[model samples]
Target: MIMVNRFSRLIGTLIDRAAALQHIASQCILCAAPGQKGLDLCLPCQLDLPALTQCCQQCALPLFDHKAYCGQCLLSTPAYQRVEAPWLYQPPIAQLISRFKYSRQYSIGKVLSNIAARRYASAYIDQKLPDLIVPIPLHWSRQTIRGFNQSEHLARYYSHHFNIPMKRFLKRCRPTAAQQMLTADQRRSNMKGAFQMCGDVAGKLVAVVDDVMTTGTTVSEASQCLLKAGATEVHIWCLARTE
Candidate 1:
């Protein structure tokens, strides 16, 4: 059943891209090599995608083993229940995020979300999929500046693939400092009271989606809000986690 659905999605994507491919048919995204059949990437560039096979089950850090939590996650603990990320924040994927988010190539959001949905389906079949997906919210000011919230786009992709629902469960209370510029302590403090749960997620399984997670502070704060709103658990599904 899952395989059929995935195959259907792949075919649909290919058909959807048929028109767009006319302009860039033989191009590899990462290395600028040639392309294969209909894939946007040549085999080499596609195969070379940086991935994290071994990581902490709870935190998604590139790790020595699943049993070994990263020292940071072990020390203070995080608010999210579990984490899953297919890629490490490196190379082509990292640059892809910049091009997508900072450059207004919103198409990247759909591409990354599709990749994440496929990966998540492959890895987690038996687990109960989340009852609802929540995008890590951006403050209106920042969203105004950026024009749109990338995470919201990514969350919608996952919601479509998983046949689950999506809700803007949390809202950014205000524009906190850009987390990239903050110290770990500062990151935590910056996000404090930055989000509020606006609707019921009580006793329901929730998955929070995002593009990249660095210190996990943003998702942690978001999860804290949902928990306070009575969510049973909050797993994180992100495109990449910085190692």
Candidate 2:
């Protein structure tokens, strides 16, 4: 029995290594050039990604000036303290995200998660890191249909990279219509009471991880739930933000 277990573990490690080597040799997903530096993205294409050059410091929305908050945020502040998104949701980045979320492209998801993790580290190197990372949960039905939650996957990457703990502390108690199809007011209405706290977060700084931030309604609702559960602060981290 011991011998068999050892052989099985060895086989699993070999398989993982082989897969990693194959991925390193694969062609670039964007330009179809040969792989370079063990990544699917070539150097030029990687540089050309739709980075969020200028954004409101509070909400991470694209901004024309160096304002801390956008006009809407000034009117009414969001529950979360700040949002950090590395890219604007547009063009090739949007297409890649769609493939990762809807098309079951796990490789693309891994690439995106890696990029987001690097960006998060650089952005917060001089600042206070969150005590815990919480992924924006999906309803059980949605999770069953999708096989996995993209937000959870991103959270795992951040957890591994930053050595921070992650918890599925938020639960989606009710499933609502897709936020993309609704107006801002409708989105807010749809998300009301949609999230519930599954674990105590009292006096802790938590970061909510999600794939994208559109109107910020979903994260706001989730943040409100966390705060109501006694969390001291909540921050939003996402791959992209739609302007």
Candidate 3:
């Protein structure tokens, strides 16, 4: 029986490796062209991705000028110190995100995560890296329906690539209406007191990871919760930002 179990485990491992290689040998998700080199996207499609060239350092909204803060940030500051979103929420990228988030197309998600990870590594090479990465949590009910949290998957990729620890330090205490359906004020009100700390973050610098940032209310509320739980500082990291 012991030998049989060992043989089964080895077979399973080999099967998994073969599946991974097959996936890497597949074509691009966008253009259907070959030579992806392990990515689900082709080099041309990757280069054509809409990047956030001029954005506010605080909120990551696209800016017309070379300003650190946008007009909105000047009026009011967010709880998180800064946001780093490498791409704009635009076509092809938007479609990829939708497929990843709603349809559980994990290959698309992996492609997006790889781009974001590379951008992060280059941008933060000389800067202070966060001690921990905390993904924005979904309520249990929503997670049960979705089968996975897109944010957590993206965070996991970053953790693996950057050698940083990813922790589920916060929990969603209750379900809230989708942020896209609500007005900015309504979104802020809906997220209030929605998160509770799951672990101690005392004096630790944290980077909150998410797939997208729209009104910024969700991350703001989450940052406040982490700060209340004794986190020294909070930074926002997302794949895309909407203007």
Candidate 4:
């Protein structure tokens, strides 16, 4: 027992040091420019990155000037209640998300998720921190291929502020096709039945975390699994949503 305890302490110290080095409280992910206190992007990058203003509250699509719901959202309501995203899907932000997802730039996700959990959080969002944060699960095959689920890693940082539990609530029963490579219509069909709830979500509000929402297909499919498992409602929190 003594030997194991000593080894664990040593490992913990090393981890602490490593994470401290990896974390940047105020630095732009796009450019290595110094940022103001608590600012994610430096002045240049901050001003340059496109902000998605005039977005729909429920669906989170870009509105022209003074519109609420996008045309499609009015025609159809999404499964989730409200979606909050900070920025539009553009150059620098796009690159950041790609690295976090494909290139294994986990540190970027850590920072962005922290921001999402804090900035994107509302009174209801704060209230519904949920019994747990369920990351939209990736198929085992994809996990095997990519080595990690981007949403799960992103949620870890955000869950810190929300003061609620975060865990792997859903599991991929099969390896579905990648959404990136598919057409918009095909993407919807591919994600159908992609997720399964591994735990009871009944009477529980779940915060589903993801990096981006383009078609809202991926998170919706995951919500179906959670609701099927008896979840009360599913809410999505993402770093960016393209209009």
Question: Best lDDT goes to which candidate?
Answer: 3
Worst 10 residues of 4 by lDDT: 120-129
**Deviation from native of the Cα of residue 115 in model 2, angstroms:** 1.2
How many clashes show up per model? Answer: 0, 0, 0, 1
Off by over 4 Å in 3: 1-24
> lDDT per model, in order?
0.84, 0.90, 0.91, 0.79
Q: Give lDDT for model 3.
A: 0.91
Q: After the best TM-score superposition of candidate 1, give how far the Cα of residue 161 lies from its true spot, in angstroms.
A: 0.8
lDDT score, residue 33, model 1? 68
Per-residue lDDT of candidate 2, residues 115-216 (tens digit): 788888898899999999999999999999988999998898899889999999999998888888898789989999999998989999999999999999
1 or 4, which is superior by lDDT? Answer: 1
Residue by residue across 74-118, what tens digits does model 1's lDDT show?
887888988989899998899999988888876556556766788
Query: Candidate 4's residue-wise lDDT over 1-243, tens digit each?
Result: 999999999999998877665455556777777654555557677667677677897888877778877778789888888787888998778888998899997667765676566566653654545777878877777888899989888777767776778889898888887677789789988988778777878899888988899889898888888888888888888889886
Error of 4 at 209 (Å): 0.8
At residue 9, candidate 3 shows an lDDT of 100
lDDT of 1: 0.84
